[model samples]
Target: MADEATFTQLKDKVVEVRHYIHQHPELSDQEFETTKYITNYLTKLGYRIITPEKLNTGVIAEIGQGKPVVGLRSDIDALPIKEATGLPYASVNDGVMHACGHDFHITSLLGAAEVLAQEKDSLKGTIRLVFQPAEETHVGAQEVDAAGGADGIDAIIGFHNKPDLGVGEIGLLPGGLMAAVDQFKVTFKGIGTHAAMPQFGKDPIIALSGTVNAIQTIVSRNENPQKTAVVSITHIEGGSTWNVLPEEAWFEGTVRTFDGEARKTAKKRFYEIVNGQAASYGVDVEIEWIEGPDVVDNDPQLTKWVVDETSKHLTVVKPEPSNAGEDFAYFSQKIPSVFAFVGSHGNSDWHHSDLRLDDEGLIPGVKWYYYNAKRLLAELGKE
Candidate 1:
């Protein structure tokens, strides 16, 4: 409900809040200090805070009353990377960093809340502010949704900071904008042997080595090339000494897919390849599959509403699908939801320690959160 000039006036305050939060970054599911800071700020803005005991971290704040409640969510967790930005507001908590730009996410939400709270009396319906935790681990949204966060909410809107496009440029995608993320860990067990030994014992390194090559075929040979999917092995641990093979070998990785069938096919082929390799090498194998967030499938109606509402304030553009998984998809799975990307024109990619973005980027982000909620209230209240 706040006009452009009103939001612009609060720009300095938003940047200040962002700096403080960035300096004291906290990891997922353990954001006690971050929660306290957000609670204090929201309370100071005259908004009522609801502390759900079910939610370990984060708080839900309410403004206004009546029907057609819309929830605006912001992820409040950081990563395990160390700060290398060397900026004045770099993380004071060593080994914990806001490389994902969650600091901006939190600050922008509060900026929107500050303006919304001032115009609450004239607003048509309620606006719920969700400060979510453990987003990096992809479990926070489920907890929030289960704790009745989406109990009465009709629609939910969320946004992330993206590189390439400058401030005020918003990225929009109608359906399946992000891939479904699944995790896997496989361990191969065999008898240890000397490097020079040819027949002394069974070797797990040979089994795991062959299995890695075989897993690649799941995408190249098994799945449809037309569809989007990727399987990447990120971590591997095997062998203790350079000249000796260890009895155990383990590797973990992630799979990304846009289609449900593709995801299933990839997982099926993955297990088959591991099993075949295990049998051939005469070694025991164990596999663990961890399900992550589903595809970020935006509601057609909600997506259209976001484009219409955002076009009134800034340029709206279409962006390609992203492989990076987002927990916001969990919110979309529960209700009619729209997830957006606000460009920051940063030099480094997300999750990098050298990430850099201008503080001015938070201005448009603030207006986005403010206008999205206010416009949703207006449109939904009419129905």
Candidate 2:
């Protein structure tokens, strides 16, 4: 634990950094400036930096040395939402905003780095910090993992801000905390004809509409009743004019599931249903399936350790599982890891343009990151 003066100074710095990041937000896979800012700060702290070749963005830095390396990760990308909070430091990057509280993520992790650096020589084992990019697109963790960012890491930990919980609270769930995410895009092609002459041509809209209804069954009907799953058709685009049927129609959506069997069933049925509907409508169909992050399954032992230890410093609560997808699932798949939900006490939930996060959450966030890293390093060192 840090002294009051030190904690106060660290908290001030965290808020400063958070507001700076909130104002100059960048989108996923395009976080060049964010990466540079993180790299510069870590470099000044005398941490060893690892540059990933496959990824254009993201930063990995480390302090201390020896065995039992503990990894701490934070996503540094913003969403494509326009700011509506009207804060003094609202986003200046026109269509981009850190609506997901990533500004808080980046700041708290950096705060941990600053505090840890002062005691780097006395620390036991290494502490690796990963400032990941493209989490919104669900590719950053895989990219970082492929680039060996998780190499030599014994255990890892991460967190997301929960607007529902009050400040000073932390939510923990041992198994299957977040759902798996998969995406698909379908295109239907048919002859264009006047709306009045429906019999003259095959309508792609009919095929698109049918496919949308069919995919819903993939969750409600195909998936086992005991399991959890969701199939959402986010957007559909087809005709430009009301009178003429469009020659082509396309729709894209996402699938979320917590069970592996449920996830597999959903994908298999999605393809079969889409193709079946297109054939029935006499329209040509094209399908594109993209595999996103898997379910964020927390290691039971690691989660227990985190809760038992952090409860001494912060309030820990058991919360319901989230259907939201997290790319940190990739790291959890490879190493023993625990993902926490820190209370931000925001006015609105994540990804909302009007979301307003209380800055008081920033102090607890910095404490969570700094304390968790120290405790993990200490425990792992014992083994």
User: Taking the candidates one at a time, how many backbone clashes does each contain?
Assistant: 0, 0
Which residue pairs in candidate 1 have backbone atoms (N, alpha carbon, C) closer than 3 angstroms, thus clashing? none
How well does candidate 1 match the true structure, expressed as C-alpha RMSD? Answer: 1.5
- Candidate 1 per-residue lDDT over residues 279-326, each given as its tens digit: 999999999999999998888988888899889887898988899899
Query: In lDDT terms, which candidate is top?
Result: 2
TM-score of 2: 0.93
Report, for every candidate in turn, its global Cα lDDT versus the true structure. Answer: 0.90, 0.90
lDDT of 2 by residue, 114-137 (tens): 988989998899999999999998
- Measured against the true structure, the TM-scores of the candidates, in listed sequence, are 0.96, 0.93
RMSD of each: 1.5, 2.0
